[model samples]
Target: MKADVQLLITADGSHTAVNQVLNKTYHSIHGAYQESQRVYIELGLFSAFDAFPDGPIHVFEMGFGTGLNALLTAREAERQQRQIFYTTIDAYPMPPEATSQLNYDQFFGTSYLTALHESRWNEPVEVNPYFRLTKIESELQALQIDERFQLIYYDAFAPTAQPELWETEIFQQLADLLLPGGLLTTYCSRSYVQRNMRAAGFTVTKHSGPLHKRDILKAEKVR
Candidate 1:
């Protein structure tokens, strides 16, 4: 596949997602990364990771995007003495070359950059002593994972940009992969998405968002 393209940055220093044609229109590119941090790490996965009294943790991710969130979590696990099993999926995954362009390496520290970029597809790859990543390079609706998760990072693109991937059936399929009380967090705040999550058998809750966004949501699966 051709390399995935990124949008031009705005005067506000935020980038947008543009099509290959260089159109000004597309989804929120920078916001997606920021939102992932606000919802998944700050509100969901990190808290869940802390709640686990034991060491080693398992986290499932809905979108692999630039692997930003995964990298941050990996670094945390590496430093904090807890092992992490992080699984992420994507419909149109960016090449490792594109992933390397992002400066997460600088901010998240160079400790795991080599291991993070070298993680292979189609198998479980360990990036460090504490972090193991399994990447599924397929659309969200087609996930075929058998592992159970304690936390989920739902980082898919906006519902407007990709509606089919955020539907109830897909959420239900994801919910089935989680053990009881596993937490799932996302940047989406649409009522329909919340209702569908409820139908997927999660106890949903709405919460404040990060700097620019209005609100984010998290759903807890209990069964």
Candidate 2:
């Protein structure tokens, strides 16, 4: 089924899409760009780079909504001169019409955003010298991933919208996919969600969230 999306201007003047069927916004209404920058880029990617410090970073993203996170990561890779292998999975990939309406490119001053959405699915595409992207179209629970990653961006819809993705079993699968000392970060810091992560054998920590949100979760595979 094709998703019906409504374009919206977030607090920071960036565009975010709302899924009409699910009644959920693809990003925070407070500020889409700010939320992605703080949650995924600062808290997740930069922290991962600090932890490892050397080697190409491998990233696994649970939801590739809006392609905002991927675009930001690609820019970061080039700015820091870091090599990143990004693998993102999305069951409902947005169509070109919806993606083209987004104004994320205005901030970066580049055509990378368009290139990212235009890149073929289920195949690796080098967005730039420092960033390689592979977008997979599959349901997270059904997909089989053989490779492990150093960082994971868990950007799925909230538990209220998709509880199955937040279950202990699902988190266990993610934990299994993380290399030792690797971490997973998400915008959700709900107690039940943290409990599920702990149940999956992850060392979970809560951190300050972006605009309007109070806390977020960072779960590590310590063992």
Candidate 3:
């Protein structure tokens, strides 16, 4: 069944995609940009830079969604002059009409967002001097990435909406992708999810979330 995708204005004046069939939004209803900035950029990318300074950073993101996270990450990379190789996977890639409704350009004031969307999938495309993106058109179950990454943006749909993606087995595979001291950040803070991450060999930590959420989860590979 095709998802009834529609654009909705979030609390922070950004746009989000709501899959009516699944009864879920592509991002937090409170704020799309706010959630991406706090959970993924501030916590995931910046923390990785602090921990692993003076080298290229590889980021693997689950659920590419509206490509908002990718655009934000690309902008940050250029601003900080940091080398970033970003890889994101999505089974259900959004159509151009839906992505066009997301007014990220209003916030960032750059056309890089268009470049990000127009970039070819299943291949690396250099968006700028500091950032490169490889978009994989595949589901998590079919993914077989070889490189161990320093950071992962676990931006999948909520566990309640997609329970199978949050299971122990899935977490185990994700844990194995992390380099030692690697980090994974997400907007989820469910106890069962945290416990599964721990079982997968991560040292999990919970931090204050963005608007409308109490906490977010950040897990690190200690080994």
Candidate 4:
């Protein structure tokens, strides 16, 4: 599937993509870069690293929208000299034409974003010595893998747009894919979503969200 997107500048003067089909923005409109930095990088990645201090960090992302999260993680990996293995899946991969227009490269003063978008799908490519990435072009429900992750970036469209992804079954599958003490972070903090996560055996906690958002979720697989 192809995603028709329109590039838009966010409140933090960063670029984000709006999916015309889903009527949803890839990142928070308030601040795309800020949101990813807070919700995924700081809250999710750093926390996972703290929990598992040694060895390469393995991250699985539910949505690979604009590749912003992966790019930031790769940058952090290089900066901190930490090894990272990132695997991300997307049902409707954004077209190259749309991604080329994003200002992330200019904002970050690097061309890593372009490299990430051009990387081959379903194969791991070392973006740098500290970071390796594998992009999977598939729907989450149809995906099958034996690799377990220490962190999950649950960046799918909102529940209203794709409620199936937030169902108990889906959450259970994700929970099974996480290692013990693994974390799953998302911009969504809806009560029903929390309930589903809880039913799937996760300890859910609400955290302060980024700009324009009240609360986000950081669920842990304590078993």
Candidate 5:
């Protein structure tokens, strides 16, 4: 319920997590757009979903903060005529008005994108023909979902601010909710996180670092 936690861009243009260390919005110096495109879009989504072109792909997002990624993915799925079951977990729900202020509609088109804003806190609404959004509006620990996901967007505040969410047990449970070959991507390059994912049965990989940092994580939950 606090402010949007804006960042002060450096001369080099990397955005830091002023509010929280790990969950930074974007640093212009680090090429926020580039990092996101590389970690989440290129490596995470494209690589994760490629072999399963005929799939009814399911995405599980941790810390559904700005809703930027959701809008982009939803619009892409719609364009490709793909069926997406997106389940995002967030302890604090952002006001719909704040989400509306973002330029999601400019990229995702207003008609359906507007609905996506109002979709917050609703009763598991199907935003469109291709997108089914289920927002768990409680602590992530309290969520009781048995369905596994094909892709997980591991976006959280950060280890320094909220370490419990990034612990091994939580990621392990996330792996349990995924089928073999399911992918989990995050902007974090923490060794502990990678080790935890391995403990949870993921086949971990070190990917090219984002613009801001030197490395990122892409792990697969293999059966």
Candidate 6:
């Protein structure tokens, strides 16, 4: 179905999906690879490992998108020899052929990209010894899961593009699924979004953003 989605190369020469309907790219125009590394991996996943430094790290990604973040996290898990269970939800999944056209694997020098898309939805599949992925085909607002997460990669479309997913109530609901000290990271630095995270019982902090942006947000479930 997504066979014709325009693929645009970002600053770092990585491809991202351009949703013409929403007029938004799946990742930053500055650099899709760089953005994921900084916002999601460095601040989100790495910090979680630092805080816990033990077995079985759980991650919930709000958007599956290009699956760039998931692939990157999987490589990291293997390298660090840490056990990671990653669950990502996306209501509208891109066609598998579409994801294959993305240049993320070439840019990251990894070969696990195909396995990620092939992994079944709504079921946990072991991508490797250290990384397991559960791809849930559901909208963030409609998602229901009993498992809590130590890290959340909040990679939804911008509020201007998809306002409903960024609402206070939605953030509150997501926060309810987080373990205390869990981190929620996003490329968005909008004041109102941070305010929403705060309203949802997270302590929001501004972090150095990916290229071309001033700041991103990292919200912690403090209670």
Candidate 6 to truth, TM: 0.96
TM-scores for the candidates: 0.86, 0.98, 0.96, 0.98, 0.83, 0.96
Off by over 4 Å in 1: 7-34
TM-score of decoy 1: 0.86
Best-matching candidate per lDDT: 4
From the highest lDDT down, the ranking of the candidates is 4, 2, 3, 6, 1, 5
lDDT of 4 by residue, 30-128 (tens): 999999999999899999989999999999999998999998999999999999999999999999998888788899976688678888999999888
- Model 5, position 219: C-alpha lDDT score: 91
lDDT of 2 at 62: 95
Each prediction's Cα lDDT score? Answer: 0.72, 0.92, 0.89, 0.93, 0.71, 0.88
Kindly list the per-residue Cα lDDT of model 3 for residues 1-223, writing each as its tens digit.
Answer: 1245888888998888988767899899999989999999998999999999978999999988888899899899989999999999888877777777778888778677777777788989999899999999888988998988999999988888999999889988998898999999999999999999999888999999999899999999877
In terms of lDDT, the poorest run of 10 residues in model 4 is 109-118
Model 4, C-alpha of 167: deviation from truth (Å): 0.8
Cα deviation of 79, candidate 4, in Å: 1.0
Across 136-200, the per-residue lDDT of candidate 1 in tens digits comes to: 77866666777898888887667766788688898888888888888888878899999999988
70: Cα error in model 1, Å: 0.5
Error of 4 at 173 (Å): 0.6
Superposed model 6: Cα runs more than 4 Å off: 1-4
Per-residue lDDT value at 154 in model 1: 84
How many times do residue backbones clash in model 5?
A: 9
Give the residue spans of candidate 3 off by over 4 A: 1-4
Off by over 4 Å in 5: 1-32, 107-112, 120-122
Instruction: Identify the runs in model 2 with alpha carbons over 4 angstroms from their true place.
Output: none
